[model samples]
Target: MTTGPGAGTTVELVKLTKAYGATVAVNAIDLRIAAGSYCCLLGPSGCGKTSTLRMIAGHEDVSTGDLLIGDRVVNDEPPAARGTAMMFQSYALFPHLDCVDNVAFSLKMKGVPVEERRRKAREMLDLVDMGKYAARLPAQLSGGQQQRVALARALITRPGVLLLDEPLSALDPFLRDRMREELKRLHRELGITFIHVTHSQTEAMALADLVVVMNQGRIEQAGPPRELFNRPHTAFVARFIGGHNVIRSADGLRAVRADRVQLGGGDLRTDGTVRALEYHGTSVHLSLDVAGADDFAVIVDEARFYDAPLAIGAPVQIGWNHADAHPLAS
Candidate 1:
């Protein structure tokens, strides 16, 4: 009953597994991406996030289990037959073709007339704010501009699900941030499902409504970004997400946010020596070497740290509220 690219199809993977001979890449993972939501599959290399995305896009055949789009099974469907479009990390725009023509290529393949497909392609270009450069070849545009053209090409299919494979990884920091915002805006406007794969936690945290963390071809945790960040259920989740310190307490292993750690005094206190100090423009991160734990960290306001700097090797007592601590599995 949904319309436009916003048809908002739900993608479900039930006991999905992808194997190559003796090796297993995706090991019986089950995931349900809700209709119209932005989901990010986050992990380091070889974690199977890319494999999972490719399988969803029909680029890779599922080794086992059911892959569903909406109510129907799409495991045997071709990439174009599935209501999904993938924008690769490389952009993959045609160098010889102009912007509009590149976007219109898919429509041309479908046997649409040149004039109609070009018009539709231009409409897509305008949606991504690249309409004015419709005649420019991929060589004439910047990296971000070419990415936009590629995005338009993908959206022209009016796909229910748009898969992005590290789409911003190739861009510089500034353009990456800019394109990240553009992607969020496009998702909002189109109301379609976006399954983005990235190794960068910052990108996932900034863009996703749901974050799926994977390790060694398994999902470590999957939840809202704030939930996973604030209440990581495992040490792996805490460590991999960053900004959290995994420490052992009397109750057992637990994770606490670095920013919640009070350096001076509170109900729960621990003593450690300052081993490293990193100053960001807004805050200072003090890495502490506790005797019984791995590197623990605390983030203090920049002004507070500069007012009374803690010298390296200085023994410091850090404390936090008991309520701020969350228990973690071994």
Candidate 2:
């Protein structure tokens, strides 16, 4: 009923584990990344996102568990031998090689003839809309261009799994958005599995067909973007992904979403004073102080805000149906 990135078989992680002596880099976990799927390992820094990605790419040795590439175990294979191409966070483009040569580096290493490698690289560059910049060196290209070259280089190898480590973190907002669309298009065109790692919630929401939520070396939740947003499984996820106020209930035993409360209700339901209202073009965010409950905020339409505005001194009542509140039990 839902989908995110690519379409194919599946990439299964069977009890994957990675540890650095006493420090657990990745706890025992199981995951199945759908084939041709664009899955992002999303979490804060030090959560072992890169470690999990590296294990899949064979950059880091697995402590235990099986990694299956389309139903075949790949735990013992080398990165290249495992049929995966990794685009590192640093871009990792060769400084001396021009864009074309850099993009063709892998093919050339694989014994692809000069002419064939050059032609393929040029085709890839054109696919990335960087054909005109083929002759430019890494120093000559902008940051975004360099990143694209890194991507093209990875794709030139035609590997089964494409491992992207925070690929868009360096680009500005505009370029990041454009590149997100480009990545989606490339995934559609190539039909290869994409496993991306990113800490940015916006990027994960925009780019992932499936999101693998990680924290402190463990998976928190994994699901489609909409499902994760609309029905987060834990308090950490609710607060981390944004756009929702997790409020503690009156008895201090539960947290509820602020937007779930009906503003036109008989009382806005427990007495609270308006603290502040932050207005965006389309919506107004209300900061409230509810007695007997933790502080919270609610989002209302800008039109609604204007039609019935509440001042800072105004007392408000807010409550939602029990069924509308999701219990964060994870």
Candidate 3:
């Protein structure tokens, strides 16, 4: 509970897989999460991200391959023995117990003395800024406060690797943003590896030092957030990451960031009819009906957009510099 760094163990998966009867929820996939780094498993629903996390946590059996934590292969280890802790989407705090008792429950099961467990619990609550709510039941706290309690509980055992499954999905937008800051701070202070699973591209970009994009139980790309954004390897990654538009050209398929596309005046030019426009505070998001591209879009600066605002259904020429277009794998 002290404010210094905690040593985090490295996690690696080699051909890890999970199957339920004939359905392979997680196909053979390999990944390495560095010690003390924040990694996010990103994809749409049923992409095997949750299954992958569960396998690492030892909650689900790996159908094949090895799971290594630091130097040991722990494919047969129990959840409590895996040196990992999972914070579920529901918060999952015990409704009948007060905050302190909820956090101390694991220690109690381990046969730690009552006073000692309570002391450690208080320290964890203090770590999460929930010390003042130690005596309150879970039902009495707000959604955000309950989340803090759950976080404290997960950290009470001093896990080397923390696994989160959509931990922010239940909160409101404001609280989600605030909690994102708190999670980042905790990762910095604790210096522990965090493997978080989420379908939100924005959330992954905001928190992950490494982003792993999954589709159909396979990794499409895994790299630093900026690398994946600036140079996505495939059309799926470009489309799923939200801001990039995939276009088919004479040479092959390519991707261009929406902000880099201009209404006119660039090396590559195309004509499209504006289909939709959305105001997003600092920029305008415009969807266009281009011939070969589905969901073709562009982002224009607020000041520039207002200067020559194009109404929906207006025909306009859109283009991007040749340097901005990144080729994608077929």
Candidate 4:
């Protein structure tokens, strides 16, 4: 009741464990990603997120585990054997080929005729809104455009499973935002399985039906972005997702959502001195010093702060309902 998104897909990982001699990259784990769902493997670098993704894509051999794509186990399948396509962090487009040719390269290998491949390639490009740029080479296109070409190329195969490894990490913030929208729209239009891997909490939050949190070759949690952000199970998630004040008390665990907490609402009722404030256009990040409490930083909307009592060096009361304080994995 405290944490979970309404279930969407049915992806299952049964006793999946990947190891390299003394090092275990992915521990024995079980997970389910529903079909036609957008799931993200979120974790810091070297936390087995990429390992987990490669295992699913058949790029990395599973040490000892079963991978299920929908209902079938594909543990021994090759990358080409599985109905999956991977869009790597590097665009990996052919520089000599135009956008359309790059998108249709896989189709050519599949033995489709040139006309059919070109047609399908153009269709996929149009889906990503890159049809007009089909005549341009990789050099003529921007980073984001090149990414779109990669996405189109991946989709041209009509892959039942799409594996994207930090596909948008190369783009600027503005382009990333736009591509997020494009990805969301494209997912609905295609209705295929999308498994994305990234460390950016913002990317995971903005685009995911299921968000799998991983650390140290293990899964920390898996659920929707809203559930993970609003009710993180551990301090790591709270800290990793940013704009959270994690505090431990005899009462229980507490984390103040920057967007949910009221700033200095009850003056002198709580024990916190405003140490610093950063104004970010429409919202403010408040750094509070609480005695007997760890630094409880919060994010509050500037518009809502009109009724808030926030002053530098002022003692203020900070409060949140007990219902919001939920248990998490230690």
Best by lDDT: 3
Candidate 2 displacement at residue 192 in angstroms:
1.4
TM-score of 1: 0.96
RMSD of 4: 4.9
Worst 10 residues of 4 by lDDT: 1-10
lDDT of 2 by residue, 1-330 (tens): 012224343678888999999999889888988788889999999898999999998899999988888767989987777778899998999999999999999888889999999999999899888999999999998888998889899887777788999999899899999899989889888788899999998999998899989999999999999898888888788777876656565433344555666675632256678989888888888888876545577877889778988898798766667666766764
lDDT of 3: 0.93
Which candidate's TM-score is highest?
3
In model 1, how large is the Cα lDDT of residue 202? 95
Distance from true position, residue 207, model 1, in Å?
0.5
Q: Per-residue lDDT tens digits of candidate 4, residues 1-330?
A: 011122223457898999999999999989988878999999999999999989988989999978987567889988776778889898889999999999989888879999999998998899888999999999999999999999989877667778999988899989889998998887787777789999998889889989999999998888998888888988888888877767776656666665555554522235678899888888788888986557777677778765654789987667665555556556
The best-first sequence of candidates by TM-score reads 3, 1, 2, 4
Work out the TM-score per prediction. Answer: 0.96, 0.92, 0.97, 0.89
lDDT of 1: 0.92
Clashing pairs in 1: none
Clash count (model 1, backbone only): 0
Report the Cα RMSD per candidate. 1.5, 3.6, 1.7, 4.9
Better of 1 and 2 by lDDT: 1
Clashes of each: 0, 7, 0, 10
